[model samples]
Target chain A: MFPALLHDALTVGAVLFVLGLVGILTRRNLIVMFLSAELMLQGISVSLVAWSRYHGDFGGQALVVFVLTVAACEAAVALVFVLQAFSRTGRLDAAAWQSLRDAEVPRRIDRELPATDAAPPVWPQLTPAGVRPRRDETAEPEREHV
Target chain B: MIAALLPTGTTPLLAAAVASGTVSLWLLLPQAPGSDWLGHRRGALGLVLGVAALAALAWAGRRLGGLGDEAVFQIVSLVAIVGGAATVVTRSPVYSAIWFALALAGVAGVLLVLGAQFLGVATIVVYAGAILVMFLFVLMLAQPSGLAPYDRVSNEPLLAAIAGGVLLALLTTSIGRLSADPPACCTIPSRADAVATAPVGPAAADALAADPLARLGRELFGRHLLAVEAAGLLLLVALVGAIAVVSRGEVAEATRKGAS
Candidate 1:
């Protein structure tokens, strides 16, 4: 039962890791790319916990604690860099920093994009509530500011 | 003829599933080649293929090694895997972050089922509660209104999908093989059995736990003391580094302005 559980958990981890890999490789959004990196970390965490469970060793669980710590530190530092990059470039696109790429690498030029055909998001509209009060023209105008 | 073309072995079937999955992912990525053929309909087709790919993956998994019998594991793992895929493919960074949170929840559930009760809860509290919220905050700070062009297109979608899918197939296959001949060093140990019977020094025995949580605490404080201190130091450095960069960057900006 435990072995089966390990195998299944590992399979799930593999799937997640792959998804993250694909995301980081394909997506051009810096934030999304970092999110993919986090997803990979998560996959590693799950695998570690599963192995720890199977072995009954505190080693795996202990490692997970360290992973959490490291991930937190990484996020803090990396997000600062991301923010800095964004400030410099005014874009969250990872491709925006291709100037830093090796000179031998081919430059990435974007192809012309077709106009967006996606429908504008439907916003909820609230119906006007309650009746408008009638103005009383008969009332005397009392206070003008001194 | 169709039956003749079908995969006869686990490896072949897994390969087939992986190939199909790669195509699905490629199609699902923003601005995939041939995506213009269907105008706005390509996304729907990709969704269909993605689901089919998942079903095939599940089938291949059952053949590779018997999947766990627990219903909860199946549900949570499915949630995690599906959420992870969505997190990757979602065009909007905000939506991606939200999907990632759901994936984190599913991971937490998987951890709980795996019996690391503390880690499971910690995953949710630390990852979902803290880290994910941070990701959302960054997205809010950085994302331009509406969709950016980068979000509407991908970098090498076909190659990326193929690479990821092939790697996944390899990993799952390796894990499946391990199940057939699990290492003798790591036999299954129940929670109570592990706690009660773990070989320990006389001093360390006192640190041994009556409960899993206490046991974890003992391990953390007792066995891994120096590592913990180092982690703390790392956190401090990260904090200082982040602040320094932000401040120095502003100073540099001011200097550049003065020079100009």
Candidate 2:
């Protein structure tokens, strides 16, 4: 027989689902948004399992297997999309993709996006270790800037 | 509406507790002003208020029905709720991802408590093991440069919290209503009817009531055979799609050189 915790289980699942919803709504980072979507999936899985136990049926458990499959595919496709977007934009912010919208829609802001706080990629500087490099005065005074 | 949902005796106290708690959470979560999380006065007050709401909800639940799987439910649900909220509120994406795994572990605990042995274990294996790993992998590659600008600020915390609170209240209240007045859909069979309708053959009933995991396998493979095959096809397609997507960058580069 199903125990009396049925409502409690549902409530907990709902709570988690709502919190995940808030995460998705409030966060702008694409990866975090995807994680929040996964959170929502977890919430639904919890509810399905609870209902399965209540009915003394294994159908819900079987269904969750499908859910897992879908979630996996979703993650794969979504990550690929993020990678592609990052290659073009060089950042993970969702706002960067506003260009994808229809031309009729007004832009939110005309100004350039604020410079990201993330430090630019650092490359190792190869300096001559043994001796001072001789500058060729004849080579147009070797410009100071690259 | 709150009064209509809960019993008359606990209604006022419950409403006050829930209201104050929502307010506290609203203030506690990082707002536009961005108060210091560790030492802020409102943050501490929000924590207390949130705990008070949890206590009130538990009390109401206990009063309505005897705690089923009492200890396990209490501990796991508490942990799940706390971990979930933390996942939502944490500023750092990696920390949020880690907290999400913790929340997922807690949800898996709930699934176990509900007698879903396979579902619980699978959730852990699939989510914590595979999905979280993929998330972390993408997160790392995407953010090779530390925290991004978007991670530092939330889009709309207050509005999201209000929406979340409203949805939570609606869901919990519906749960309470359903508990007090169960819908006609789920009618449990009486012992006499169960025995009378039971399979006459000993093996039949035994097989039906065999180990849950074994029964789950039978149900999946036997009843849902087509769905299972379809799922397999879907997985294969996804694998191919992922491979194609990842390789497109190189293919495009090669094509560009040929054209030039």
Which predicted model would earn the best TM-score? 1
Interface RMSD in angstroms for candidate 2: 3.1
Give the per-residue lDDT digits (tens) of candidate 2, residues B146-251: 5555675676567877887788777766766666655677555433345448866664444226488888998899999999999999989988998898899768
Over A1-146, each residue of candidate 1 has an lDDT whose tens digit, in order, gives: 33667877888888888999999999999989988999998899899988777666778889999999999999889998999999899999989999999989999999876555377879999999999976555564553231
Local accuracy of candidate 2 as per-residue lDDT tens digits, A1-146:
22457777887788778878988887778888888888888888888877776666678789889999999999988898888888778878787888888999876442333454336779999986797778766685557554
Estimate, for each residue in B1-260, the C-alpha lDDT of model 1 and write its tens digit.
Answer: 21222235555766667777788788888883345567667788788888887777677656544453577887898889888989999888999999999999899999889878898899898888888888888889988998888899999998999899879878966775566554677555455365558886554454234477877888899999999999999999999999999999999989999999
Worst 10 residues of 2 chain B by lDDT: B31-40
Candidate 2 chain A TM is 0.69
Q: Pick the candidate with the highest lDDT.
A: 1
